[model samples]
Target: MTRRALGRRYLSAWIGFSAGGRFSQALATVILMFAFGQPTVQALVGSAGTWAVLVTLVVLGGLSLLGQRYRIEWHGVLPLSLLAFVGYCALSVLWSEYSWVALREFAATLGFIGLGLYLALGRDLVQVIRASGDAFRILLVVALGLEVLSGLVLDVPIPGFGIRGDIAYGGPIQGIGGTRNFMGFVAAMALVTFVVEFLTRSVTAWRAVASTALAVIALMLVQSPITGLAMIALAVTALALWALRHAQPRTRPVVNGVLGVFVMVVAVVAVLAHSRILAEIGAAGGSASRLALWSQLRVLIEQHPVQGWGWVGTWPSEPVVPFDVVLAPSGLPFTSALNAFVDAWLQIGLAGMLILLGTAVLAFARAWVTATTFPGVAYVWPAAVLVLLAVTSTAESYLLHGAGLMVFTAVLVIAARRRSWRGRLPR
Candidate 1:
């Protein structure tokens, strides 16, 4: 073969590897569970896991650069908003109370943003979504295997690692993610992905059925209230999108407007009846601490209302900021504000929060419109994930960190492309 032929073949292989190959899938699993020092992987690999994640991200990013076929496209203000958010985070290092910690965390967040951008720009939205689904499938399988071994074979907690048997939790299973809540989150996402694939006819019927069955079983075993509730919200969103997809184009805007109003009303009512909603979910008592934490965080935000405390990635247990000092007195240690919006305000202040929220609202609106107007299931990917993130952000601080943030960025990229495509097509 000629030299040119060999180069082309090598590029093809590299593209395949980074897109949705086994290595990519496995790497994603590691980043989601172990990269940020989840207990089980940390116990097994020590601090090496974090280094491994950094090295892998660098390698994949390098490969993406070499394998690029087209220039990276920028959609509009949405992408700019995201870049501004990251830039603001980096700038926070200068004013941060703990400059060293802020700098370190900023680097980590930047790495994730880079990884997300690489995936979004290097591949089509369908390919990227499929790649993510592939990763979730493999991760769920591995988690189930570990859960079975711990719960049935060993009947004892794994030494050093935090893998606990079903017997220990009485019923709920943690799986390999090291916590029931994390496992539930993964399982919930898996279910959504499988359903989308099935609807799109991207996967064989049997494969879809089997993967979705596994996800449902894992979700049941994990029994996380937050994940369970999030799934319900996703289901409702999916149904609404489906109806809109089937509706006439002229009627969609009206339908969407009414739905928007209804959702806002429901949200207000839920907030007003927050304690009742918590009681319905059996979390009323546990939420007292979260309410208290929110109250303390509000005071701290007032102190630095414009440009709050610097971004710390994850909140430290030792009380790094003024808010942390107040939290320390409660005798109940707090890591996150347990709310993404609150954490954003606490970390980057009001300006950062507005940028983040504005970006999200715009992205979700574009994705929803595209999904409803477009004919394929591919468009539903972004809409579904955005709904999941929005619902979960209320109780978990996953929206702006680690794997969750990465996925959020990728969805934004996809939404931007959809808008660009629509703009170019003849009316």
Candidate 2:
């Protein structure tokens, strides 16, 4: 064949692969794997791995999106809240003191968002949950296996990947997540996914049970105070969802109202009893460290209280102003403000922070309503997952630009597609 014909032939074949049904499911799995494994890949393979995965998936996801473009509802397809959040982040480049950093970070953010969009839009709700369960299951298992090797047999720390090799001592093991708390957070998320899978009949009962066990074991080993808080929130949300699902249709309004007041009461009590809660969860020291970090961040945020330093999604490894101004209690530079909201306020300012919070608030409201009213157990998954993410973000900065952001995007798309008013318009 002539070179032109050969090139055309390859293009057609690529298009076919991208549009395949099986390929879409596989893409969802891989996107999550990459999202969750990013820290591990960065630890072991360096920045090149990050770029390679980002670039390859960006090109591939974009092509796949194009191939199946006709299937998606083009009229009001994108979630406006999420779109606005991202747009605000992108606009930060205009006034960013570190223009190059802003540009670089925005590119990475787009890459994550693109993959998340593909995962959400390419498949149905059950498929996304299955993909999530599978990713968490695989990562948790691998993490445990490595902890065994490093902590049991080898008895040495894998510093490069941040595996502390303390499993033998009953772990606060970092695993592949780069930190004990992060692994705990992921495992807690896994527990939420696995429980939903069981309730929805997405997986066999045995499989669900096993997955839940694995997640629980991992969570215990990590012993993260932040994750303890997440578990409590998840447990409460799960009970609330269970009650909502079983309530009589006509009486659900009363149930919802009561639940709303209960949630408020709990919040007020939590604030009043924070010292006891912190001690119970063993978070007093971690809480103190975080408060210190937040205090420093507050001083920095005051400099450009309205506009912010710029949208560097994750802090630079090398110290820079604002980010450089704050250090961990360990006397090292902290990667995040350790709180997603504070990070948002520091990077994008008050307006951007409001937009971000608005986006999450709308998403959770929509998701909670869907869970109560929607027929399937799968409807509850997004609501419960959002609870975990929201509660976890108060203590950690996971919801920004990596696995957490991708997860937030996927669920936002899922819940929004069903509950968004835009869906009411004629296509």
Candidate 3:
């Protein structure tokens, strides 16, 4: 093949294997399926595939060096973020209530960070973002479709028919906690992509109808109405601020005013909805069980405030399920849990909180700027992340190793790079 053809083939292959590729999504699907007991070995293979993406990035980085033709524009605070994470992990190992467990968490966290860094910094950011976004759209469609079918058709004697906690969420949709919020989060992001693309691309009647239908369908399926509710507020607020700062003076006030109204409305709705959750929480004496277990976390941090828990092991010890109330009776490691932030802070202390905050500010700030420059790039991932931080803080703890942080980091870095490219290219 000619040099041009070789280069084209290489580009295709790179895009195909990157974070957003079909292979990656397939791996994710397989993992979830395995969690549902599709096959132990198959699940393990899927797990290996996740790692393989990380390995590919390392190998790709080496290849780029050999070709001597690669360039990275913005390093994007990743190294500092990763380094701080390492320090926090070390602290956890030293002070962890569950020392051995914390150690495993530490190792797992390190591996996850390593994988994300390889993809975010080394691979082609644009391709990854586009591919990942596309893959997410596909996943949303497939997941929602499966959810409907399983609910309507496969409900009988179906073993592992719903979310088994394999790949974040799968199988039949559990009520509030059973992948409802999780899939809602994914759909919220998809809505953002749809809107952003609609703004830039041709908004044909069919396209508009399809997007409107999908958005409504996702809202219905997610049932966690607040998820989409949050996105609307964030997008309006983020964009209005951006426009005020960067748009022409004549257009600025108008854009800001319109977005301002949109935001105010969203805020009012969110406040009312949040009040309901808080009311329920208060009436029930708070997410106390989660709070109680989480309170031990505070004790752990206070003991090692600077680096409260030892990083390498799970130091703090408590009964796995102290609470009498049962949420998911069948789910293993069941507890009254809500958010990742609380767990991290409890496990790692103020320092860990700072690290997480710093990571978010740096990553989100970059993404915000990018979104501002190319409004088309503005999407729900950032908004979804904001809600994830809030919701997960209330229920679960998986940001470091789970799909949440990985997808969030991958999208933010790629968005930053794409914004940079748009800046350089001639209009």
Query: In terms of lDDT, which candidate is strongest?
Result: 2
TM-score of 3: 0.63
lDDT per residue for candidate 1 within 4-40, as digits (tens), equals 9999898889876665545554554444444323445
lDDT of every predicted structure (CA atoms) = 0.75, 0.88, 0.49
Give candidate 3 misplaced runs (Cα > 4 Å). 1-69, 74-79, 94-100, 122-126, 157-178, 202-212, 225-229, 238-246, 249-303, 311-332, 335-337, 373-398, 411-427
* Higher-scoring candidate on lDDT, 2 or 3: 2
Error of 2 at 286 (Å): 0.4
Q: How many clashes in candidate 2?
A: 0
lDDT of 3 by residue, 116-159 (tens): 54445554433333444444455556665555555555543223
Q: lDDT for model 2, on a 0 to 1 scale?
A: 0.88
Instruction: State how far residue 208 of model 2 sits from its true place (Å).
Output: 1.6
For model 2, what is the alpha-carbon lDDT of residue 177?
Answer: 93
